[model samples]
Target: MAMNDGMSGPGSNSLKGITFLLVDRNEALLRSFQETLASYGAAVYSVCDISKVKDVFKEVKVDVFLADMEATGQETSALIRSFRDSNPGGSFFLLIDRVTYKDALSLIGPEADDYFFKPLDPDRFAQTIETALGQSRPKSNSLAVIEPYVEQLKPYLIFRSPEMKQVLMNLPRIAASNQTVLISGETGTGKEIVARAIHVLSRRAEGNFVAVNCGAIPDSLMEGELFGHEKGAFTGAHKTHRGKFELADNGTLLLDEIGDMPLSLQVKLLRVLEEGVIYRLGGERPTAVNVRILAATRIDLIK
Candidate 1:
């Protein structure tokens, strides 16, 4: 079916840039599932025939796989094994009714990432999918406790030094909180990577992760870059523009090399942080925003 034809639904655009492959014996159920995901800006390819799954996989790269356990029957395990062998990175979720739920219990193995009951609620399904995609790594208390959340950071960070470990030890706690963070480290120390890891681990992981280098852009343009501008706000402003804060609404924003920002810009940033709103250049009203800020610097302001 065609995906995302301007349909409105819960968590609008939350699944943007995501792809799904859905399989089921019932065409109605398949269509419903496709429409639900498509409404959230997902590219969905659904098929009622179990045999056509391989052909679909060959044609498209799928991030998440949803299959009806009743349709697969005894071959469920083999199908999951084959899919995982070929696409180890993809996530697999099973769909089953209450009647088959008990029987399907045995089929839930390492290959299946999760399962959803039939007659799925769209909001819950979307939320669950977002949560699963956000927490890409498998859950393991051993890594979070014994190893100090190192497993979750493996994809973004690689460190062996005790000092680095000590720095990372507080990562989980910091990520769980909603407060702003200041990541201080010398240049080339992977402060950006650490910021990315924090964003990935935070509650806003499903939202956009935006980063702006304060030192790279000219000071004259910094205000417009952060607070955006209305159409005709300036000689060059022909169209309305969204700033970094607007773009990162409901997500995390990393201000890299924050120490380089001019004092005037810092005051404006502090105002936005305190008020949770921004005034576009040449605009009269304020636009509220929900963003988590992560600032990185090579210089120590504290000292």
Candidate 2:
């Protein structure tokens, strides 16, 4: 259904500067919706193929994603999961027709912010988007406390939520300490970005910040990846290789997805953390590393 081109009354530009991505198979609906949102001063972009959503996300910082669940078909849940994995910060709104409203409602959990039914009120839809943006906007008081840090992180992180501001408020104190920190949150929630911010605020700001994804490395090669290896230590160990620990000496080492590390390697990791020394593979002597360790995990290790 297409919306009329009637000019909205005063306060019509409530969505000014807001970026929106609309996903729907119906071209006519997309054009009308895009025009309505654009009239309200929103930068609107539409896509028919859900597969191109990720590409658009990579190219632009989308403020909100309005997706047509009916058009998305059976892959809606999986696509939403992928969106959360890649851009957990962006707001997601599902557009469902009356027939599948209940089914779409089930998809609105931590990942989705809200949902709207098909044949939407153009004014109401624009107002809803503006309201969501307003609610997530950071309060002045909270922003004041972390303004400097936020400024420093502008190039690396994009967040303006009170929850994130609260998290940032504790960063200064946390960065001052030499103790190891475990940052736990859902996937793509900017754990790595926080780790980098800590490094930037800490005394090790001048030193290198090295990050290693514990889950990405193979189990067989994980040990050598973290502790380095001497020449001929393994089949492909042609020369002495420096591991993440040594590379981050006098700096910060972020072990991302730490929960994925193998149990065998965890023991060694504990020893290294306690001793501040690493015994490289096939090496008799221990190498001391003056690196601060920051661990990030998506899983609940406490459980």
Candidate 3:
């Protein structure tokens, strides 16, 4: 389905430039799946070779990763964790046989956002993918027409709050620039929704808009989570993982709850902000990221 013009605040379809990495050892299934998503205007890359998953990620800029759990199984869990650790910004899903739907849920648990059962229902799959994409899309500035409730949409977002409308009016103008934006608001104020509107209105709307919740991350691994780490960088590091900066190389990075970030990691984060480069935990090279940083905080950063 085509997204309404300017519904996402004046950009093209939210899916237009976003990429999907569809991995399955099964050629027929992978093709069928890709075709289904493609019909909905998705930019899907289907990969059949399991061994080359890393190669694809390294070369391609993908916004989401969808894998066949039935085909990948436990053998891929380590890979999944590794992927999650490195590319914390991308959304992940699993495709499983109907009989193993429960098994799929149990296997991936919180690791995966959702999964598709075998004999895939095209419409349902489309809806699920859209919802997941909405969740993944970075919040931009847009008019918030607070109705009794807000539903995800393409162009204009409906909300009932007049304050939100004022914010939306400014979005179009604000989106024209490429300066770093830091949104401050209370919980449930829809900081992300606003951020996404800005993304849709901005020049980089065609590129990926990745969100990373700084507060949701555990303090223990915050370093490895944002900057990634080389395999054997630490005790549990079995493989090289991609960090949020790497995943959002040319996209927008929403640093949610920046205030909650531990003081220790703040030093490293400041360097990234200033230098536009990240150092993997165990790796020596400082990789550069050309990303638009949009941060949200519930507290008064000025204070």
Candidate 4:
């Protein structure tokens, strides 16, 4: 039986950057899953030939393995067993056709990380895959956290002046915390470098480090650039964009040239910082984000 949601969004929300190996007997179904999921920033590779599973696993860094198995339970179990032997860290999900849903439950529910019934909800299916992958994700090596920072920030952390020394000394504590940082320095003083150093030391080191020049963007499009815009928010907005804040979710966002930011946007910026949410241009609902903000300014705004 053919099942599909047909040109809909991901089976779940936020499939961005997820890589998976999708296995199913139905060639067309696999292709559809690949196209639909890939359209939403997911890395999906369709595997119609189950016998090629070993070969596929060898080539892909698969985060999740989703198989549609209407075949014998014995074959399904054997394949899963072999898959686990090769990629134990990979998340597994079973897709059972409605007719065989009941019979497959016993094999799928316990052994697999998760299961989806036929006629899968694009959103729900996406959510299940994401959730299982997250749960089964390998724990990052704690010791390795400092390794990256040392390599990236070595050049910037070197300065003989007392003031620079103080800044470098306190950097680790600053980076370890989620507090908003205000960096003040003239142009060519490496303000952005400092911001990157802070991000490297933070838990968000693995996440995105987005920096935007507040003065570079025109006043007309500043808000839209910072907070994103809905499709048709304004002229030429063909599709919705995930602004710096959204792109930096669970990460660090550096708003450089803060002193040059227009007063009107500054007020809105403060509100977003306080509320931890932003309303996209021409959007009805406010989108929430968890972003570490780093602001840079050279001029004193006290006057």
Candidate 5:
């Protein structure tokens, strides 16, 4: 049976375990929202201080961020833009009064996945978050893409090989601690599967997981794909966006084919790991994230 850790608050249904960050300038509304979220089993962090909002996010694992669009339209947009730039892969919900819905959408644009009108519909709001979470859920089981017997070294993988066994034994120990694990193995040897296994057994098992192929993206766009780009950062960058690092902030990020990563990009990636933060492709502010990294490569990293 699944053990209940009672993170839910009043009025929270079975979906209370998901974490949501509520950012509003109004203290009263923030508390009310927190209470509602807690009742349903959610881990809530209410932030009324605009100055500390980003700081709070750096430390907490927020599944969905709900921001008030009325707090200084220009500053709010900039804040939202910064949030998107830093967390390229995370999801967000916007809260706007009925009068400002159109303007908010026009200003925030595509970066806003869903919006909530004032005099909110609790049932519908809950449903929307649930659906968004469901749609973005990564395929956890090994058989998601590969057949049960493929023996493929991918998402869900199995191996009885001696080298593989050594990796498996060390996985739990590695996953339980915070360490940078470099998975070096031959192709088709299930390197990615080893990464997935580590994530599954780790403390962040319930959070989202994202996988990116360092070798697949072009050298020019690799940073944007991994860290994200701000609107007008480049000619085609029409709007603010989040990248994989931000998306997988509280979860795991599987870096496949790390050996093929360009030298320049390697420097950037190393900095992110070392600095424990990231800046958007065109932006200068760094965003902190909590992500378990699992990298797979078919070549010798040191060579």
Candidate 6:
């Protein structure tokens, strides 16, 4: 049994219980659309800043991702493809101008569930969303799906070596808390699987588990990628964006290659750990977020 908690409003067209993540730089438009859907009881998470559409998933899981295709600078087809890669079971819809609707139709064919043009018709907008939610009907099994895998792996999980047995035995107990866990090992030693197993046994089992490789992302974009930034903060800034810390709120964030993180970013990360809040780049106010940090490193941190 997965935890699928949501309730619909009083009518047939209610998008009740369907979680929405809306992306658009136009604050008024985003708010209007959110109000329209939220009025029907959909749990909404929104970030109207950020260049790439796929970046929003850094710390959040959503049933439907609605975006402004062109202004966001993330092409319609590519956004659909990238988001679908991460969330194969997730639903996606793009908002395009009528002038480019034909191009959107041709490019995002079968990739996105649907699209709507600007100056949206309120009734049709709601209907299109309802239709998209309706298409993703099976609902996600999520971390609950990992249960069968746990049992299958259990039989072969035993360690004849004393050193390995003790480590395995303590794993379950460690997973039971909200503590920050450090997992270290040589390359390809099943460290990620161990982390997943821990997540499966933990209370956050129902929430999304996000993983990011510190060594993979570029240094210039790392701050914006992890802490997010406000629109107009930089030259190419398009909209408000949420970082990985925000994306992982109420869930797990696996920080792989923690050692590879730059010194300056490490300072900011330490602040997040110590204060439980993060200040987005170029933004004056700090945003509070709750994310369980699971760090992994190939090398020993101390000498």
Model 6 regions lying over 4 Å from their true place: 1-149, 152-165
**Which tens-of-lDDT digit does each residue in 1-303 have in candidate 5?**
011223322454645558777778888878777776666666777777667767866876567778887764667667766667656666677787744654654544356654555655444455445433432353443322222113322446454666654565455445543345788878887777778776765556677778898889888888899999899999989998999999998688999998778899889887776555788978989887666678889888777
Clash pairs detected, candidate 6: 48-240, 49-239, 49-240, 50-239, 59-247, 59-248, 60-247
lDDT per residue as tens, model 6, 1-303: 121223323244367767778788888877887777777767777776644445666655567887777665546566667777776677777777644554555544367665555666544466545533442343353333223234634643544566555555555446544557889999977677777766665556777778889989999989999999999889888899988888888678898989999999999887776566888888999897767789999998997
Candidate that beats the other on lDDT, 4 or 5, i.e. the better one: 4
Poorest stretch of ten by lDDT in candidate 5: 143-152
Displacement of residue 233 (Cα, Å) in model 5 is 0.9
What is the Cα-based lDDT of residue 69 in candidate 4? Answer: 73
Candidate 1 positional error at 35, Å = 32
TM-score of each: 0.53, 0.53, 0.50, 0.50, 0.49, 0.48
lDDT of 4 by residue, 1-303 (tens): 011223334444346767778777777777777776776568887767777878877886676778877743457888777778877666677776545544455554356664555666544455444433332333442332233235556865665566665566556546644557899877877789889888876656778999999989999989999999999988999999888889998789999988888999999987776566889999999897768899998877666
Over the stretch 108-178, how does candidate 2's per-residue lDDT look in tens digits? Answer: 65456666656776666775455345435654545544554556667666677778877776775566545
Indicate the residue-level lDDT of 65 in model 2.
Answer: 82
Which window of 10 residues has the lowest lDDT sum in candidate 1? 1-10
After best superposition, candidate 6 residue 56: deviation in angstroms?
51
For every candidate structure, what is the RMSD over all alpha carbons to the true structure, in angstroms?
A: 16.4, 19.1, 16.2, 16.2, 14.1, 18.1
Task: Report model 1's TM-score to 2 decimal places.
Answer: 0.53
Model 2 backbone overlap count: 0
lDDT against true structure, model 6: 0.68
Write the residue-wise lDDT of candidate 3 on 1-303 in tens digits: 122233332122445666778777778877776766676677888777667777767776666788877667765676577667656677677776634454554545456655554566554455445534553344545433222113322344554577876775566545544457899999988899889877765546667778888889999888888889999999989999998888887577889999989998989887775566789999999897767789999999888
Q: Clash totals for all models, in order?
A: 0, 0, 24, 3, 19, 7
